[model samples]
Target: MKKLSLLILITVLTFSCGNKKSKSESEPENITQVNPAENYSGTASITQGIATTITEDIYTCDRGRKTDVGEISSTDGKTWIVPAKTHYLNNDFPFATDLHNSCEGLNYDTAEEALANFNAANTITIDNDGETYTAYIFADNYFEMYVNGEPVGKDKVPFTQFNSSVVKFKVKKPFTIAMKLVDWEEHLGVGCEENRGKSFHAGDGGLVAVIKDAQNNIVSSTNDTWKAQTFYTAPIEDLSCVSEEGNYRYSKNCSTEGGQDGANFYALHWETPTDWMATDFDDSNWPNATTFTNKTIGVDNKPAYTNFTSIFDDPEQDAKFIWSTNVILDNEVLLRYTVE
Candidate 1:
């Protein structure tokens, strides 16, 4: 009986040891391992100490609307994965209360004239204390901005449903800011309006902008303080004529060539300025910019603009006509501003 008990105890001890060893050996060598940095197969670059990687090709409109029109890989988790059919606005951002137009009234002398005034450009100049400044601008069609004759940037999107642009640059005490605005015309001759004839639609134009210093103080904006001049004018002539298409009647005779009339017709009545965008350009004779209130559109929809009073005092005057006397015949306008 003693021998049997000893044998059983020995057998139990061996089984326990075997089970412990098996359990220990079955455990993983390491429970956690660090993942290696992903090897991205895309364009990578460092600019201004900021690293940017573009994993997939992006298509952008001339005005800077970005769309992912290329293949996206799921193999690398680092790639920015956008859902299928995603649309991106300029700079991959959204804005509010930026939509403004000078021709919302459409009661101007002619549709072309309304569009031209809306297309007019203004240059605003404000003295800076040698500090960094930022600017935000938006136009009906489009605008190109320059600081001291150095191109800063232009409107990302041109035409209706306006998009705003932001630019930052260092400035001296007194600097010149110039902008060229254009009311994009589908037909070089006729403006963009709805249902003139076949595709004869004429569109209006306008521009509003604001600038701030490093302290975030308002320095400049689109207002009466800026000077403006029309460098291009078209379509609206003193003479009136009917189009062969009979889709719409013209307030001016756009029949430059026989059969090439109506929407396809174009005529220029103004001359462009020579190097008007230069800092030294003399605009002493230019008229002050007319203040127009964007009553049709407000901050509720266009939040990008903050200084409503700079354009108009009364919100009820929205969509009211504000333009120079020559707006009816001018197509292209040059604006000048010198920092005081």
Candidate 2:
């Protein structure tokens, strides 16, 4: 009898231990997944991340791919373009150039109007603060220009050449801009210091001012395309703000492991203009918004970790939503939970 009682007690304790072990292993202890219930736009608020100095000594693989000029990044230059040696003498290059000899400041209603309207054909201004400017329509032979109305440099410079004299110049409050543009044959043997590696065709040749700032900084620039190269055009959009084109959205998750319901929550926001609606909003498209474990599986087949989805609907705006995960918060940082 004593042996049997001892055996029974042992069996009971063993089963209890087994049950406890099974329960502990059935649920994950440290991992939680969340799904935001909101739709966010491209112009969402961005907080500054951790700051660190960049140097050539720290050669990280990812950072090495991007062009680095001083501390500024070429990939991040929405306001500037890559520095090139040669540029267009005519208004053919996009809306980037601010000066050039080929631009005519004529066809104005008055002299005051003439000063206001720099480029005659295009709606562009070359010398904005200049008091007096000259323009000439010429055909054939070569080209050149001199500041303050006289040429200190060589004349009849061929279209195949580029002039370094066409640089940024700012003198006092008001100034005079004089330019003489000529067109001619392809091989005039004229040379330019900047156009050593560059080539130009006779038909496309024209005068263009390379755009730069007062500090000699290249604001907007482009170089000649290779003979074998192809060109594609992209429409301009605002950089400081995000575009509402396509289905644009952002998301994040917040969860806990020891809550009463054993789950967490999330928030979502987006713009739903009359034309663009979030009715067709697809959450599965979001890479990070998936549930951890499918509840369709029975408990015995389920993984130790299971996450629930929480979504948010807008209060003021019709196109906003907030989402979150439903996970029991254990003895963790649940009290400090907050949404961004």
Candidate 3:
């Protein structure tokens, strides 16, 4: 009877041990960290995924493809187009030559009124006590000017009815002049403006400046001597036609010849360096500014430029309309020059 009792005790203990082992295996010690009511069968790593918010900024256009309107991206520029408040004249800088056509709903301060209402004290100062110089500028659409790495002034008009400006600034000689020139877009990244009953017509970009010293002697002008780099190029039916050997963003291999097929065309973009306007920024690798003729840029009909031919189109020390290799296709260009 004692032997039987020993066998029964052993069976009971063995069963108990088996049950305990099974119970321990079924529920892990780490399971207590999970919510009691939750049924998580597996462990998977979690993450905050990339943002998918839709944006039309040409600078960020690489993340999203252009969407269709009449052609792709017609509604895109509204996000990039500065508000009407951008229309106000920078007081010290008046229009040497301004708007030729009436841009409805926008108030234009004429050259006469701006010159008469000019404010001397508020002009931007790179060197407050330095020599005063005048910059005569004409851009196809827009420009932001920098003198020796300081913000001197920007185009009163961001994008629109063509205008030219004269900026008076106090800066020392050997100053680096940097400009961001944008060709206004009807389509954002694709760089096309609607015309000729086609929704995707490509537009051109040009910028010219003549800087004169306080003595009224021309010190510098936009020409092939300037360093130019293109950050935005577009209306490309095929991208293989474009390439960059160093800073030479070549789009010349492609045809700027097509008109209507830009509906689904592609655009190329690059992030502009933050210190691009700084005096010490190294641009020795940048390509020479490609010069464009008045006829090539189609400036004959635009009085803002034509009206000031003596300055911009001067026969003696002419400031060439400079852009990237393909003005018709390159939309946003950065130019740099040093007046030593």
The TM-score values for the models, in the order shown, are 0.49, 0.18, 0.68
Question: In candidate 3, how many Å is residue 166 off?
Answer: 1.4
Task: List the candidate 1 regions with Cα displacement exceeding 4 Å.
Answer: 1-129, 195-198, 237-266, 296-329
Per-candidate clash tally: 22, 42, 0
lDDT of 2 by residue, 216-294 (tens): 3332211111000001001101122223323322111211111121011111112122211122323232222112222
Q: What would the per-residue lDDT of candidate 3 be over residues 1-340, giving only the tens digit for each residue?
A: 9999999999999989877756556756655463311321212111111112233332212222232211221212322221111212455443333223233222234434434545675456678678998787878877777888876767655555666777878887789998888776665446676776776677778998888887878899889999998876766766567766756778887766546544456565555788999999999998989998889888898666776787776788988999978888887788899989
Best by TM-score: 3
Model 3 global lDDT (CA atoms, 0 to 1)? 0.65
How many steric overlaps does candidate 3 have? 0
lDDT of each: 0.45, 0.22, 0.65
* lDDT head-to-head 2 vs 3, winner: 3
